[model samples]
Target: MTFKANWEKADKQYFLSAEIIEEMVRRAYTPKKLSSWSVIAGGCANLNIKINFEGNKLPSILRVYLRDKKSAYHEQKLGTLLKGTIALPETNYIGDYKGYRFAITSFIPGIPLRDLLLSHETYDMDSILFKVGGLLAKIATCPISKDLVRIPANSNGNSGFIRMAVPV
Candidate 1:
């Protein structure tokens, strides 16, 4: 999704509120003391915040889905499947908060690939692409569980929402 479209479509209700943050922390079974919060920019499908809890050195990410629960469910399922295989943030919680679906996961450090590609002029693009290709290769080898629902096909071979590299 385009940055403008995603930003404009972002859910205003998902803005960081004391109550919501508290609830997210509680659901994640984290310490009550909140140290800091910062908006994490990049993703177009969700609003994210990196939250630091008191006495904990590592931060956690709160992702508020801008789409329907189905999108959240799809993400959660994919995360679960890729947990140990991929270097993904550990998912802590996924549930409805104030009528909006949200997920809390362990915070991962580093700039997003999109931002790096946009800002850097002389970076090693080949190396980065090779790494990403390796990661995708690993994901392709993973055995998908039978319980997980596959996305229905479309005329253009794209899923209803996100485009898939392989035919779903």
Candidate 2:
């Protein structure tokens, strides 16, 4: 099937049933009664559910890929790419379960940086950009693989991410 067709098909089947979540969990680890599963909002591209199973210490995030089936795999690769560059949720399980491409990842605590920054405190544009730049610097240095390394965007080029983080 084509990529566009696959994306549309996954979007139509967005709902992940409780039984299905349980089944996905079972494939990753020993199944336990799911204590709670709540949607984690504010994501731009995917469905994130903060789920807790009986006897688990920390919560796990169940992410359902909406745009593309390969999203889960790409994220798994990204986690590896950013392994030591910054703090990232460890992917516990990633698979295509019954046409639903998803991943169960270890929940990293704390609110998103966006929420933290946009709160009641008054932060000027430059301040936010500077702080965001620090984060970008870390990611900017992430290695794609042993043979290839990530190069910082030439501020002269059209990479907005580099420009936002570092004003030339």
Candidate 3:
């Protein structure tokens, strides 16, 4: 897949400096040297970078959460929980660097579904939809663990103070 550095123009605000990315790379468990990096250009709440390493066959994704520690922790927990059961990438590292919480995950190679649908005029919509449906069905069948609950005890009440619990 050809990676686009869209953050160089429209999404420049979400771009991370090479130094920061290098620091994140050093903090990771991988011994591979940094080759190249570019912003993934979709997320609004976090900065996602596609990182390539020298002598490594697959690239990794580095995500810096802009929301808060809670949001970062929630995502990390979800990634861990869904690791084996789902097709999602395995998170290799999750920690704070220069006050910003980050997570590095093994990159799953593919073009984003939205990008494919928008760019290709003759794309196979039926097959794509079927695959998506199957994936969703599999996800639905996965049991939710009780220990994963993060909602407040009183959040599900009719009281005005609490309305609904939103998952990160």
Candidate 4:
């Protein structure tokens, strides 16, 4: 399904007007001309909106947290601070908010990993297993932690988001 269509399906519940978008643009103080805008992806957590500017350039992504939380903004701030250390998308805009926060960043171009994997007709089962093993091992050894992140405290465990369970 197209990103725009999927986004509409998920975010049509909370409709946002063009004037609100224009206000958001103004609040962001972005120089890019917003010729068009649409939702790219959305979920119970966030609505990822994509904006097409006047330059025929690539679209940018805006993440609006569904719940009232500043974790998204914190994540962006931390990413900016650690840009050189880690490959993080550049944050271009941040919107004005009274309760919920909104932020914009350069769209990270790529298919969702799930879509990419599913789109493949076939794969070497052994190789895929080995790659998954290697990836997990690398992640296990990685030294990332909440300390490196300036995001809001996830004081509320689970926070109504889905959690994955994998058998070891």
lDDT of 4: 0.61
Order the candidates by TM-score, highest first — what do you get? 1, 3, 2, 4
Write one digit per residue (lDDT tens) for candidate 1, span 49-144.
Answer: 888888889988888877766776677778766665678887678888778788888888998777766663778889988999999987886656
lDDT of each: 0.71, 0.70, 0.71, 0.61
Worst 10 contiguous positions by lDDT, candidate 1: 158-167
Candidate 3 — which pairs collide? none
Regarding TM-score, does 1 or 3 come out ahead? 1
Per-model TM-score versus the true fold: 0.73, 0.68, 0.71, 0.60
**Tens digit per residue, CA lDDT, model 3, 36-145:** 88888766468889988888888899988776667766666666555555678777888788878898888998877757765747867899879989877765654455
For residues 1-168, what per-residue lDDT tens digits would candidate 4 score against the true structure?
233323324333666677776667657855757888887643545777787779767887767766555767677755654554445678776666645478878777865544445454665757866866775564444344444432332677733322222333
TM-score of 4: 0.60
For model 1, the superposed segments whose C-alpha errors exceed 4 Å read 1-14, 149-168
- What value does the lDDT take at residue 149 in candidate 1? 44
Clashes of 1: 0
* Model 4 stretches with alpha carbons more than 4 Å out: 1-12, 42-44, 81-87, 117-145, 149-168
